[model samples]
Target: MKYLNALRNQWIAARGWMFCTLLLAGLLIYVMQSYVQLSANMPTRLVPYDLHLMEGPVEVGASAGYTDEDYLTEIAVADTQLHSTWTPNNVESQYARFQNRMTPALYAKVGNDLQGRLPDLENSERSQALFVEHTEALEDTVRVTGRLRAWIGSEQVEDRPIAYRVRYAFSDGVPYVAGFSVEEE
Candidate 1:
């Protein structure tokens, strides 16, 4: 007991070593807590919650990979019911000249139409179940191939099947389609 008391008295006489030991222990605890939090928040895989963002919709142009000729041909073939004298060559020239002339109204109309169809395509319970099961297997970029039919004035214009590939960036748990292109199938 006398020896232990002597050692304690000597250690207390110095004081600096004891303070340093306490500070180091506190620092170690703080570092360990930060490490745990960082590991907890790290992403394990790409999920829908990782993709939904509210950036403005992108525009489609000739440089988007579809040639003027291709766009003209698609428009013409789709608008067979229209009795216009406009030819594919003429439309191609117009599109070539106005490649950068995308209007907000045009994009809005396309987005509205797409939104309307999404309920039918994406809201099915069966499809959702399938999506849940195999979503990991789906590519980050998706290629959607479909045809669009719209009524222009009194004419029923059925556009040919156009395959579009869209690259999506996942944000906020939803996949937002960011860029699009027409693919030749």
Candidate 2:
């Protein structure tokens, strides 16, 4: 309390220029901190993949039985958008960073399953998707099976091939994944 009183007395006795400078500096710091906090909560637009970057299969198709091309196209776009956000070949320490980068809409499609599969996909260098196979279709629920070559290291694990079976349903015209599971191929 004594120190604060002394500082206040000193500030009042200081020259006008010094007092104004100190006041401006304090105000500047407050504005910058507020701006940083505001921007931190806002969603940022980031494109992880290069505009001309091309990797993996150009076409994604199922084993058979899928007739809806529009749905397949949507699935491909979502997969491509999300895959580009996965952590690069750094290490397990940086592997889970991709989950934080996903936008709310993008996250809605695969949030449940993808979040759980981060560990398995940590070392995935790349994949060549066979295609999206629609196995079950109902009024609201649709099931899609995806086959891809998951490369961990230099060696490709193929003996127990894995495929994702995602179940999707529409809520107010927006499709969301109810759940997903990996099936052995």
lDDT tens digits, residue span 61-169, model 2? 2322332445533553353334432333442333234344444564677666655766566555643333444445443334444544444455555333344444444
Best by TM-score: 2
In candidate 1, residue 170 scores what lDDT? 38
Which parts of model 2 have CA positions greater than 4 angstroms off?
A: 1-14, 40-144, 150-153, 157-162, 168-178
| Candidate 2: residue 57 Cα off by (Å) | 35
TM-score of 2: 0.37
User: If scored against the real structure, what TM-score would every candidate get?
Assistant: 0.26, 0.37
Per-residue lDDT over 44-160 for candidate 1, one digit per residue giving the tens place of the 0 to 100 score: 652333245726432233234322333333332322212111233243333322222223443354545543544443333211100011111123444444443433344655444
Q: What is the lDDT of residue 3 in candidate 2?
A: 100
RMSD for each model, in Å, please?
Answer: 18.6, 11.8
lDDT of 2: 0.49
Give the candidate number with the greatest lDDT.
2
